[model samples]
Target chain A: MQSEFAVELRDVVKQFVTPEGNLLNAVDHVTMQIKNGEFFSMLGSSGCGKTTSLRMIAGFEWPTEGEVYIEGKPMGHTPPFQRKVNTVFQNYALFQHMTVYQNVAFGLEMEGADKNEIEKRVKRALEMVQLTGMERRKPRQLSGGQQQRVAVARALVKLPDVLLLDEPLGALDLKLRKEMQLELKALQQELGITFIYVTHDQEEALTMSDRIAVMSKGKVMQMGTPVEIYERPANRFVADFIGESNFLEGKIKSVSADEASVFVPALNAELSGVPMSKDFVNGEEVVISIRPEKIRIVDADAEKDGVFRAKVINSIYIGSDTHVFLDCNGVRLKVMEQNHISRLDPHSFYHKDQAVGVYLIPENTLVLKKEA
Target chain B: MLQRLRENKAWQGTLLALPTTLWLFVLLVIPLFLTLVVSFGRRSPDGGVIYGFSFHNYLRLIGYSTNCPAGQSACFDPLYAQILWRSLTLAFWTTVIVILLAYPLAYFIARSHPRRRNTFLMLVLVPLWTNFVIRVYAWMMLLREQGVINGVLGWIAAQFGLPFQPLQMLYTPGAVLVGMVYEFLPFMILPIFTSLEKIELPLYEAAADLGANPFRTFLRVTLPLSMPGVVAGTILVFIPVMGTFIVSDLLGGKQVILVGNLIQNQFLSARDPTFGSAASLILMIMTLIVTYFYTRKFGFGEEIITA
Candidate 1:
């Protein structure tokens, strides 16, 4: 049986030495495990050390502390070329002098494969990346997306144990990026190789990853599946970063094993949700997060126990849906409603400066413990 | 256009270019053309060209100087061919030496940390800021017997209790080569540095990602990308080295004679304008042929030829 983790980093720390002899911690104590045949993503904002962590795993960087292991073997001081891991950089870094065929064949050449085997493998790798028949063209002659595909083919041609991609599609256009995202996901599944992808794009992580480690300030903020991260985030940073949400300051009014009631200071009412964090005492300060789509809009005349009244401040007709901005108590809340058959012209019921009531889905709203 | 010419802007550009273009034509091109014309003419006793045409200068260059006096062997002799051959050989060796030395230095300047790179390049160029003659003269002092180098060698030999006579380092072919390399090394470095600087680091990283080691990456990627600089630097160093005279005149004493020395002797000491013109024309033709092949080999097409 295969090992549980294909790539593992334990308390990896990387500090860059300045010319004046000061050290700046670029990657600080990052520890994570990537499962075999899984598309694992490290998502974070810029300068958050996600790429540094990925480089450490790829053997391009040596951690200042702790070790990086791949396939149950210690990669103590291995160079990047000697490691059985390949990287696809953000800029697609294709060799400008070589043709596409030669770029893909470079690794096979290094492996000392037979002439026929090298040609066959290079062609196969190019086919995998859908870059067949353009083998003779140099990088400058190709489009950005094509260059990116060639970079992928160059790395994938090595057939390493794990493939590390540092925002590989960042250079492509939106349409091309989306297409490549799907292609990358399909390719990962078909090849069944461990893929450790790094990106600042949450949508990309949500779309392609089997599991994601959300990073911030050189630390892993949370790690879980897409649905788990979206439905039940660990903290304010993860919740606010992964998706759109409205957070309200509150205090716990009643605590239970599975449920809790938090009194919202802004609305002057009690809000109920599943307590996703540690134990909370009564009257303890807490925060509640609720997705906009989970909140339902009701007319003022319609009476509902869980409904709270809100005034429509602004409304936008976005092609497939209407984005309604409402003032709940003193705070503004955005609500997205679909233009489905059952909800035809929902905005017709309300206009700007008109009052309406919002019903929050108790199950969708989460009560997170107050972070220091 | 004539209409646009009336706008005065055209005249301004023409005015700006007038002095340099006229200088080049009158001082450089006209003199060269005069030399070519004189190459086919007979020499008057007064050291001016006679309008009569003859193949005597060419025949004399091929060692048919029988009509010339035997005592004037230094002025009209078969040594011109040997001088040309030696100049070519020395220039080739100098080009090779400078290129090997400049490559690593250029690569370091191009790829090292930006804050220190400028300072390093400036240090390399500091010696060039001095007058060329002064710099060559400084080498004379350094290489002379009982100079700074000899002082150091004598001191080291004294510590070992060995014979301490100053070594024969002055007025030799070796000293001339040292001066030539020192004078032309910067010309080789600057172009190579420019080309190396333009090579993106991502290209090397991509090569590594494709499983190539450092050596293979340099051979497959960096070397090909920087060939333009290599070609430019080689020609820049080689052509001038072949034509240079002062370094050899000062450092070589009477030990050697290059093509440039022969050319100078023909026009000055020999007072033979016809023979000098023939030699100059031959050199010009040889340079043109070599340049054509060099640029063509490096894939420089109309761009370099026209430039």
Candidate 2:
């Protein structure tokens, strides 16, 4: 039977000895399955093994243990040229001597494609990347974005089963990076080829990936859809990494099948939320995590059961939103309150030394078992 | 003192460059100018410069010897012309063979494991640590009629019950060519290795990702990228081989006579400094012309050359 996954890493471990002679797992025993036609991303900071995992899938690296499967075939130390996958390197490693057209035609010619076919496909691939009139320009003559497109075209002209991109847009300016992110997403969907993108930018991963695998210290922490990853992060690391979260030390007051109530010492109260990962017994120490935007600012006079009186410490206006820092029940909490007005209104914004009420919705608040 | 010099950067640079400038001007430019002046002067009766303008030396170089039996003003003699031609061909062939021999070794060292790469590069440079003439003498020891090679071959032939004869391997044009190739091989290898090593690892992976096998990658990526290094090595090897005389003198045993040997003989035994000056100027011009065209086509491969 045909496999559902375009690529699968089963208990993959890539070990490396440091220059200091310490054995380190560059990629731990991590297992993940990327489905066909999915824009899957391995996202993390540097040394997180995301790039290593991508390299293993691209066949640039081999797993020290377990196997990597591409299109239902176990890739046992297969060299990169023999594999049916192409890569867009982080540096956009275009052959400097080859022109844009030749860069795109390289794969076809290597596969022994006919001259006319190579020309036709090269032209089409350039057009797809909107680099049609730059056939004769060397890679040095093109801009970073154009060079990136050439790298993509060079890989995609082969019509591989999958395309692996390693931080392809990390070098571009912010505006161009954002534009290319959408363009790459559209291209992936249009061609319906699996794209395995590796990036350290969480926003890029969240914005483009159909599913994301957040990794740290060579281990896969969580793999889920964008909404799932952002809304229900797996643990303290994931919660702090994906976006932003406020962690308050707490202990479990009550535990249900999925929901749990944690008594936070900071607020001297209990908050209920669904447990993010495993089971939690009563009196177990936990972390009550909530995003900055999840907390609500209430009227001081409002009668809310979960409202805690707070003093506004500082407010920073960042055009789209106002960041309000409040001292609530001896814990400093940050609140990202969206601005509904067209322009900045200092009167609407909370000034320092003003009294306010802070309320945490139990559903938005998360309980993470604190690591030792 | 450094802080004071830093206040005027251009002055500091001039001060820094003073020694090399004085050295080149006194040793190189003055000698070249003197050679140019002497090339135009006539030979004195006492075998010194007569200090008179004449075109005889230049004309005589192009086969116009006035000392013919007919007492002619100018006549053709193919001896010097033949030596010049032979030198050109020898330099060209030596450079070609050295490139063919150097590229693989350079590529091997460039592709070797990083920890051992320095060791391989050192091995390539080891022969240079010996004095250049001594190195040539070492080749002579190997290529002489009863040298180690022929002795080994004769031993093998005797064991096989075949007639054993010492081959005439010494003092031939082939011996000179071998010596020339051995002497200049390192110059070519070093620059080529530098250029090949400068090609990042990602480039090879990018080629492989594009479906290029190792051979195809070498053909398309490795070969083209390393052209700068090859050009640099060619400049390093070809110019020196053209003007070099020691290997030819020691190995050729009068069988091979290049422009270098011609110039040397004219200034020394022949006692004709004017002719030597003209020949030296001609060699310099030829070397510069080739270098100009070659660099225009490729590049300086500046890193290693400047270093």
Best-fitting candidate, measured by TM-score?
A: 1
Model 1, A224-285: lDDT tens digits are 99998998898888888988888888898898896899888788888775555667788888
Residue-pair clashes per candidate: 0, 0
**With candidate 1 superimposed using the best TM-score fit, by how many Å does residue B146's alpha carbon deviate from the native?**
3.3
Question: Per-residue alpha-carbon lDDT of model 1 for B1-307, expressed as tens digits?
Answer: 6777778886979978999999999999999888888999877898878866787777766566655665654344675677777788888899999999999999999999888889988988998899998988998889899688999998999999999888787788898999999999999899999899989886777666666789977877787788789889998999888888898988887776787777788799888888888887777776677778888776731122211
lDDT of each: 0.84, 0.90
The whole-model C-alpha lDDT of candidate 2 against the native structure comes to 0.90
lDDT, candidate 2, A1-372, per-residue tens: 778999999999999889999999999999999999999999999999999898998888999999999998999999999999999999998888777888898899889999999899998999999999999888999999999999999999999999999999999999999999999999999999999999999999999999999999999999999998998888889989999988889888888888898888888887766455578898999887889998999998777767888999999989898899999878989999998786445588788889989988778877787972
Candidate 1 Cα lDDT to native: 0.84
Candidate 2 chain B lDDT trough over 10 residues, lowest sum: B298-307
